[model samples]
Target: MTGFPGVRPRRLRALPALRDMVAETSVEARRLILPVFVGEGFTEPRPIASMPGVVQHTLDSLKRTAAEAAGAGLAGVMVFGLPETKDATGSQALAEDGVLTTALREVRAEVGDDCLVMSDVCLDEFTDHGHCGVLTESGVVDNDATLELYGEMAVLHAEAGAHVVGPSGMMDGQVGVIRSALDRAGHHDTVILAYAAKYASAFYGPFREAVNSSLQGDRRTYQQDNRNLRDALREIRLDVEEGADIIMVKPALAYLDVIAAARAICDVPIAAYNISGEYAMVEAAAANGWIDRDGAIDETLTSIRRAGADSILTYWALEYARRGATR
Candidate 1:
């Protein structure tokens, strides 16, 4: 019989309280941001088919849900608008009374200072083509044209009472332009959350449906490639230089490496989105009794926090908050 000389790691793992005491990371309720979809022209909340227990909230529903998010102690709620109409240039995105603007105002008013109201400052949900920006005559996305629109959109969101604006379009110089636009419009306090390393992943399928996206094709041209870690860091660095208050990596579960790597190099707070497909897969498996639903949700969120995300945007935020409150 032989015994190892090293200290036994099993001592810490033997008890739940000991494991909790020595845990490297924790998912606090205040660091989880709930992502909500507000649908225009809808009198009632519509349940999204692919995302179980999630709904496309109407104006009234959105207000109530956002209030719940505040009451549950979430750090913030991210609003995504599902407009009833769309056009080539997504003119509605900049309209004062646009669906998103309206929702943002209402939610901000309801949540007040209890929770941060963040808006998705992108045009995919408002454009007929479902691309993030305007198209050129050759049907390619116009980067410069898109940046102009993004700036306009940021001001609109600020005027609508959004505390933070997230530029998820992946357009070059988007964060800088948005920051400049906000300052010029007297929204100097508005924060910019840059989608720094958003990858063009296949896991966005459920999200497309969530926004009623009309994306005829992929956004691979603009979104970062999944295989390139160095490129992701480069994107993060550029966004930092351009004045990103907080940088983000999309599809958190698949890119924990990118999230951890960003945490190592970047000084700003890091955020990660637990996207729709990630939520749906766990729900599907749990529905069939393949895994414990509650446990899966907690584990996934804990893993993201463990990977060094300062905050997490997830569909499970409200539920997790409620559970934490009860516990």
Candidate 2:
């Protein structure tokens, strides 16, 4: 046969060592953050049905899990708390003894400085209506009012020893308000991971169940539209100007373009959330014997890294870290 004129691309893939050496993307265990749920009033860890192998943890269980993650060399753990009570104001969100703050303290104490402890600074998990912010008399989300509460929540989380507080509510000027709150409280060292471009995605279904969300309706008014790419960059700019230490793009798989675009313009570290729906889809396919579970996990994570994420928040972080360690 005549030799092809063009250079051969498959030579690099012909050998495993060559492929490894030529790999452009890698997922480091120390840069992966696991999202963990700690529920109030749970005597034992409660399994989330839609998300297999994930559980709503009690304080004791949360400690154990945090310990394991730290031991596995995972960078951090993002905590979402399920409070026992809900009200119009999401009062528990700012309460010193609230589920979230309490869990933050527990996790911080258990892991110490070995791992970064991050808490979700949003009211949705504590509010009766399940909206991210407080509502007005007409049932509309009051953006300004919500900022004040977010500020308060940020201070509380900082006091509780959260090394990083992620404001995931998509509220306007949230990053500035949170930064001010932390600084005023002498927590200037605490980092703010801004959910700079969160989309109102349908992929959040499993998360709602995981946090026992009491959402009455969709959050379209607050979250960014999934169709807008230019706006995502604008959001990143606002967050960066407002002193966000890191900017995040949520629903990582569906928003890889946004992550890549943000990486182009953003100077701060960029994070992408490998959201619940994305995890569930892989789990479901793997359970059905339609996909190689471990391979899919690595590919998806690698794709996110390749798309320009400095760090990834994923449910599979702990599992992948443990497996990666063994290998």
lDDT of 2 by residue, 1-327 (tens): 467756888989999999989999899999899999998999999999989999999999999999999999999999999999999999999889988899999899999999999999999998999999999999999999999999999999988999999999999999999999899889989999999999999999999999999999899999999999999899999999999999999989999999999999988999999999999999999999999999999999999999999999999999999899786
Residue 101, candidate 2: C-alpha displacement in angstroms: 0.9
State how far residue 205 of model 2 sits from its true place (Å): 0.5
lDDT of 2 at 91: 95
**Cα lDDT, all candidates:** 0.94, 0.94
Clashes of each: 0, 0
Q: Which ranges in model 2 have alpha carbons more than 4 Å from their true place?
A: 1-3
What C-alpha lDDT, on a 0 to 100 scale, does residue 111 get in candidate 2? Answer: 92
**What TM-score, computed on C-alpha atoms, does each candidate reach?**
0.97, 0.98
lDDT of 1 by residue, 135-218 (tens): 999988999999999999999888889999999999999999899888988998999999999999989999988999999889
